[model samples]
Target: ELSMSGGALRTFSRCVTCLARIGSDLVFQAYPDKLELHTLNSSRSAFASVSLTRDFFDHFHLPADAYADAAPSSTPLQCSVLLKSVLAVLRTPTSAIDRLNASLPNPQASKLEFVIHCVSGRKKTHRISCSAESDVQTLALDRNGFPSRLAIRPRDLTRLLSNFQSSLQELTVIATEPAARLPGVDDGTGGKAVELLSYIDPTKDDYDSRLHTQLWIDPAEEFLEYEHAGDPVDVTFGVKELKGIFNIL
Candidate 1:
């Protein structure tokens, strides 16, 4: 059993919904201190995770008492649900929700329930069927190994993307010490990607439009939030998935 504030639920739902856009299944793993939802793209090129601690919720309960010998935090109760089903429940307007309760009587049960407690005491329980297949394993990002990194605010991204043409599906991240490419590797798209990076070279006029956030990170300075060691790296992703992620942010 679990109860989270309406705001927390909305935030969690939005984040998870975005993750769902990148993958088909949402894997929820609960520990004593936190809950985590992990998802990975089919190509395994893109992955995102949301971790919420007990402090993030008003109340959190784990049925560990039912099993005397069961390991607590070490043994996480995990279950996978279809992305669309989860998204459907989250699509409801947040103003109507006051709190949320999620539970799994049996970790191996075929379904899980999410009860939305509304401000007016009107509640709705959504039963989402659990998947029998094992959850997809995600690749651990080696931040220390990535040579290049970029930081931008959500609002900045939203504004920048607003200028994007509808026909643009993929964007290239061009990095450079001497002219590099973003998504340095190929994504599924066959056409050249629309350049989404311009901060690598400060001399370029488009640099401001691309990295207008003014939060660019250089290899010389140690980034407290991120660790990297290598050469400039570029990556690509679908704009649709990016938009979903941005919306959650």
Candidate 2:
């Protein structure tokens, strides 16, 4: 069982909406110390997870022997439900919701129950059908393994992305060091920059008339933190996923 205060309920709603935009199903993994929500895109290329500590909830409860004598590799209680179903229960604005109570009840339960207490002295309950899942699908990634890192405000990045056409599907980001290209020719103003370019396969039949766009950004001005310690590199990914994630932020 889990209960969230008004503030936490707001955050939880946003998290659910964000996850819904990323994937079709939401996975719940309950542990003694925290609750985790995870989702993977249909193509299995994009995966996202959010962890909420016990303290984040107004009330959190689990059986004392939930993990008793369990091996280190033992899996936690896991289940999945359609993202849209969860969204239906959370469609009410946070301002109208005073508190949220959720419960799995037991391992055999086929539905997850959510009770929402409204600020206007009303109560609503929703039962979302769920299915037991054998395990959670997650990607193991080491952040430090990447030589380049940039931290920018979500709004800042969103503003930059706005320069592209709405129909554009993919984007390529190129990171470069101006000084590396020409050692002696490097001007005092030489610094790191990134080029955001709209991408479309040239092999496509209509490529000849497709619009091509490029925008250059200086990290020093746009990013709160920027570090790069290797050769220039470029990565291309779908823009729709990025826009969806940022929208929730």
Highest lDDT against the true fold, candidate:
2
Per-model CA lDDT versus the true structure: 0.68, 0.82
Across 116-183, the per-residue lDDT of candidate 1 in tens digits comes to: 88889888989999986644633456776666555656776676666656545555564434223334
The C-alpha stretches of model 1 lying farther than 4 A from their native spots are 65-75, 134-150, 159-166, 174-227
Q: Please, what is the TM-score per model?
A: 0.68, 0.83
Model 1 / residue 92 / CA error / Å: 3.9
- lDDT for model 1, please: 0.68
lDDT string for model 2 (14-106, tens) is 898888877888998888888989987888766778999989999999766556667423456667898999999998888998888999878
Q: What does the lDDT read for residue 142 in candidate 2?
A: 79
